[model samples]
Target: MIITDTHTHLYSEAFEADRDEMIQRAIDAGISRFFIPAIDSTYSERMLQLKRDFPEHMFLMTGLHPTHVKDDFKDELLHVQTLLKEHKYYAIGEIGIDLYWDQSTLAIQQEAFRQQIQLAKQCNLPIVIHCRDAFDEVFEILEEEKGDDLFGIFHCFTGDFEQAQQAISYNMKLGIGGVVTFKNGKIDQFLNKIDLKHIVLETDSPYLAPVPYRGKRNESFYIMEVLEKLSGLYQLSEKEIAKITTENSKAIFGI
Candidate 1:
């Protein structure tokens, strides 16, 4: 099974001590594809080095994350634009409004999100969104920008059935992660109702670790826990879930 982790900060300092061993562990467990999202210009070199180290498995994206948007956001966007011109990226993402961190930055966050969406349209690339405590806000912008040309994954989606359907209406595949394995992570309640085609697997590793590993640092190999949970929720075999979700990832990332 070729599992795809559509969003993971594999370049995160969390794995600095044993990055290679950690990645190899995932590869040995069949989690081969890793889509790395850009946070800011600061991590660009580390992302590039990761790609070089594991060229076959790593796919890169370029964008300024919502939480990272600040007074110097315009310059950061320029850096993203310049990176786009210089490198081949799979998407423009991990970008969107994140009001949970600092509601005060809402105005600039909205502007950055809108600009990045436009940039994604210009490049004909999918966008991976990072939305938190801003579903209404994110949907509002998506409502304004909806079209055949705008399509991508709603990274780490945590919303109700209505919001899930709305996200689908915008050509977004719901990115199911470790949260699905949590006892109280509500997405599992209505996930089966949504077709498997509309879903993709992820770990958001070193972050939202699945149960049995919850409250601990997550790794790509731990995505197996998520796969097992999804298998039960969807009434499919683990291999089948992996195949379908990996295919869904391909559909979004064009890999």
Candidate 2:
């Protein structure tokens, strides 16, 4: 019953007051693995600290998040490159186009995304994507970059069946999170149609908490809520869902 939260910001300020307790809650619930995504150079130190504190449970990723892309993005990318060279990361991620925040940075976002994709390939690591309101743009770049070398998870995937299939064609697993438990979070409607092998569980914690905890502070322990929902969707037991999704995480993160 070991659940893997493939994407969770346990290093986030939301848990600053009781980070250890919060993480312990998740471990107590069997949600042991937590993959931490880097937003920028700002959080790099804290991310390292988190890895030090939970070395056995936390896997780190290095990259500049799309929303954080700005005029100084080049310098930020350089920082990312330096970190990748200095430390081992599970992936180059939480990176992609995020038009929802501001459409103006679309050009820079696209460039950053492509550059990071190349970096991921160079490092021989999978990428964890953060796509929002720019699926077409993201897919176009993925189309151009698709190859045996390019593979990862479409984190917090909120697209349709066609998009899901498209993401898979690029060797990505769908990262299912708390959204699957929402009343209107449409992914659940067609999720079962997609095989369990292509799906992985996440909480995106301190963010999209599942039902019974929706709109509240999310934590890795709440990943069980997601697991329960997935169990129903796949008609498998909770333990089986955890096993399969954990295996999928291993395939993507190579851990």
Candidate 3:
């Protein structure tokens, strides 16, 4: 039962004290694939070191996150461009408009998102999106850029049925995470209606921990809680869910 965490900040400082142990715990629990998203140039070295440590399990992406977009965003995009030229990344992502943090940066955020989407198209790589309080904004850009070359995962998707379908129309697989296990996390209500092929599992670890572990720091191993919840919601066995979602991840990441 190999599971894939399509979007996780495994290089995050949250696991600094026991990163190896936490990762090993997830591996032992059969969550072997960890796709690491880039936030900014600052974390690039840490991300590289993580890949070196777990060369087989860690997949890397390069992009400037929406929240990190600022006055110096041009330099940051340059850094992303330079990294793309120097390294082999699986995708261009964790990039999109994040109005929740600072709505003032919406203009720059949309520009950065458009530029990175173009970069993804140029590289023929999938994109992992990080959207928050900007579904219409994100979808607008996706609409403008939709085509064969634009395809990826909508990381940590939290939207209604219509939005989910719209995201699917843009070749995005819905990244289901710990939120699916939350009693009030509405995605679970209509998830069963969406085919398993359109879904992938994630933890967004050290962040949105599943219930039972909710309100606490999350680890990849805790993804099992998410898998269990999905199993019930989809009426499939846990192993089947893992297999299908992992395969869905492979379809997106091309691993």
lDDT of 2 by residue, 205-247 (tens): 8999899999899999998899989989989999999999999
Model 1 segments more than 4 A misplaced: none
Cα lDDT tens digits for candidate 1, 166-212: 99999999999999988899999999999999999888988999999
**TM-score of each candidate structure, all chains considered together:** 0.99, 0.99, 0.99
Better of 2 and 3 by lDDT: 2
- The digit string of per-residue lDDT tens for model 3 on 1-255 reads 899988889988999999999999999988899999999999999999999999999999999999999999999999999999998899998899998989999999999999999999999999999999999999999999999999999999899999999999999999999999888889999999999999998888889999998999988998899899999988899999999999999988889
lDDT of each: 0.94, 0.94, 0.94
| Model 3 lDDT, residue 117, Cα | 97
Model 3 poorest ten-residue lDDT run: 3-12
Shift in Å, residue 160, candidate 2: 0.7
How far off is residue 152 in model 3, in Å? Answer: 0.3
